[model samples]
Target: MENGNKRLAVLVGCNYPNTPHELNGCINDVLAMRDVLVKRFGFDHSHIELLTDAPGSLVMPTGANIKKALDQMLKKAEPGDVLFFQYSGHGTRIPSAKPGHPFRQDEAIVPCDFNLITDVDFRQLVNCLPKGASFTILSDSCHSGGLIDKEKEQIGPSSVTNDGTLQQSCSPKTIPFESILQHLTSQTNINTSDIGTHLLELFGADASHKFHLHPNELDLSESLKTDEGILLSGCQANETSADMNPMMTGGKAYGAFSNAVQMVLKDHLGSLSNKEVVLLARKSLEAGGFAQHPCLYCTDENADAPFLWQPQGSDL
Candidate 1:
């Protein structure tokens, strides 16, 4: 399954951690995804990497580990390579400190140690990739939808569960670290400026005037922008994505959106377009009685175009 062109994947799931709402199934979900890509999509074992909390000789990825993984991928990736990054865990949004900041908040991926993987850092990483390469990122966790847009809708408070009790808490707010440090350091960089511009566009004129709060919304168009890439998120900014229930089977009970994606990959591999895949995933989730909606954000004009995973002799 090895292709001369380098194709690397970094699958990360942080379940056993110092965070609220511990997960029981995200690791299984990542493993399932690895299997799907390797067996069905012709990915080589050497080309793909899985970083999780699974027992029995598994490499766990942390803050430094994550940086190393990304660096390795970038080092080996060619122009045509396709890099896939899948994360299952928590996300947060903090408030920005600058008064005239365009964005009202900063978004981040919550690591195992409760440290933040800021979007500014992510943007720097993305920009470093070879021009012709493409990236596909799938995130299943709270506040992930905001990674793409400042005005991204926040998930309603009703969807989350705390201490076995269903709770209705809106998504958390985030401010860029640069904004926080600007006051202390009195210095700035291009990355900070870009983030500020995006934040302003999302929060609008009131970004600097006041702290405006809203429901979580995922901006697929802004996040998944690339001529050849796609971004698939578990839920909208305002929606809650569930952890696995031990009572369920098929690895671990997945978030409704992740579950639907697994179903599409399993049952309809080659017979659906990216849009169709998302539609089917949504239908499956609703049929299973999920209350929130799953979202598929992509910048590729052909995102809605037909794509099928057909087996030999299968009808297209």
Candidate 2:
């Protein structure tokens, strides 16, 4: 018995308020993506939840709150259901915990309260989806290239074509790196080391110890291993996503990668394959003057699957 008819989305964005890591565009990015799900995609308004750091939002984008929201989203999921998750925030790399994993680091999404959500955590959440269902996640953050470890590398900084051969290789970025570049270029009182130290202070000494406190050390592990999940990341494991100011939005801000994704879907009608979307978003971001690259991660056979593809029970 499958329930392929329902479409559910959980959108999370965090702009740490009054904090040194405060960002201006993350919340805006989620809002725009949410609108796309409601208008262009088939996701219903009722089934969509917005979790952000904005004051008085229905739910805050804390680690615990986010986990709780995902639990709720998975409550009624069944085979053939389509699940969508969009996260626009800061991403970091720390030590790896996988069995026999060689790397000293793994990728994680930074929650509002400084509680880090590691790649292992995401793997668990992904496994919760019904066997026939699909979990599609878009992570717009730094060091986000391999957020779901051990997933196939379909389209990355180095692309894998339908024949499984490498095609083009490019740069990495942030929903993950935008603010990083912004700070580096703005001539502000902050430097990379300064910000790194600030993160230590903000997130506390325990988080620093758990993560080994080695910020920006990205490692891609093939050793560790999940559900039928597709990941669209803003940049490579070493690169950061751009949190850019929207030129047309009158001082408003948005994530560089998220904005590119929105442009690709908004300008085109109907659906596009995963490869197509990643390619288009790359072109759009490059044209817009952002160096951060986007990548797609899925099984080799699913490389050509449509973005946010509706689950077909028979295929499972």
Candidate 3:
């Protein structure tokens, strides 16, 4: 049975407080995105699930918690529904687990507790949505391009370097693979060279499904001609997103890409298409002297569809 079209969102921000991977702008990005969804997109505040790493937050943005929240939201979703997910945190790339995949590295998001959610997980989630529904993801983190596996890329990398190689000093939003491995080893005292083993031991079944994939299931030849996943990545898979601290923003911290998207939204009077939003955001970042380039991934039709399914002339 098709439920009436509803606006649903899952917003997550991880600061990784007091840790080596601590960020300064992620929580602020979530709060800001949430406000826009309610005020501009007409999303009911009650329908939005917010998870952050800030102190006193009721639900922390752990890997399991985030997956559970997204699962529940998708469960209630039906045809004509509009679903949105905003992630603000560090991003990383790891060698592909998929056998014979073209891309050497797969993109992933870092949760507050160091659990990573990979592109394969996102692709699975998007595949579960009903035919008429849309799931849009705004990832304000480094190495975020292609976060949705197999989705068509409307805007792609320009000068991205080889996979798994990132400029860390310029991109604080990127947490290196070595750093994550060291942290896990320190905590678990497991002397395995493979990071996947440590993640499996720490998170077990809750670990990223990429860790347990069978070699037979590694084919990437399937087409996404019928998929409805949209991704607004902060940068190319090999590039990094910038985190604007209080010192830089002169007040509240913010993910550079998140702030750019907000600025584009606020400046436009009517609803903008997905392609328009990403293009404007790219311009905004370039104007601000940020080297990061935001990219969009979705079907050709979705590239022209109104963002969040909001109609034309809808007020922002």
TM-score to true structure, per model: 0.67, 0.75, 0.92
lDDT of 1 by residue, 1-316 (tens): 1222555788887775433445666777788888776766556788777777655535665555666687788788887667778887766566654345546665566555443455544544565667667556677765565453322222212343323322122222222345433422333232444433443444343232112222232222243434444456665555556665646333344554666788887786465665676667656756665544555554444365333222243331
lDDT of 3 by residue, 48-123 (tens): 9999989999999999999999999999998989899999999999878766764698899999888899998899
Order the candidates by lDDT, highest first: 3, 2, 1
Q: TM-score of the candidate numbered 1?
A: 0.67
Residue-level lDDT for 62 in candidate 1: 59
lDDT of 2 at 166: 17
51-110 per-residue lDDT for model 2 (tens digits): 998988767887777877877888878788888888988887764544466565578888
Worst 10 residues of 1 by lDDT: 166-175
Evaluation by TM-score, superior candidate among 1 and 2: 2
Two-way lDDT contest, 2 vs 3, winner:
3
How big is the positional error of residue 20 in model 2, measured in Å on the Cα after superposition? Answer: 0.4
Better of 1 and 2 by lDDT: 2
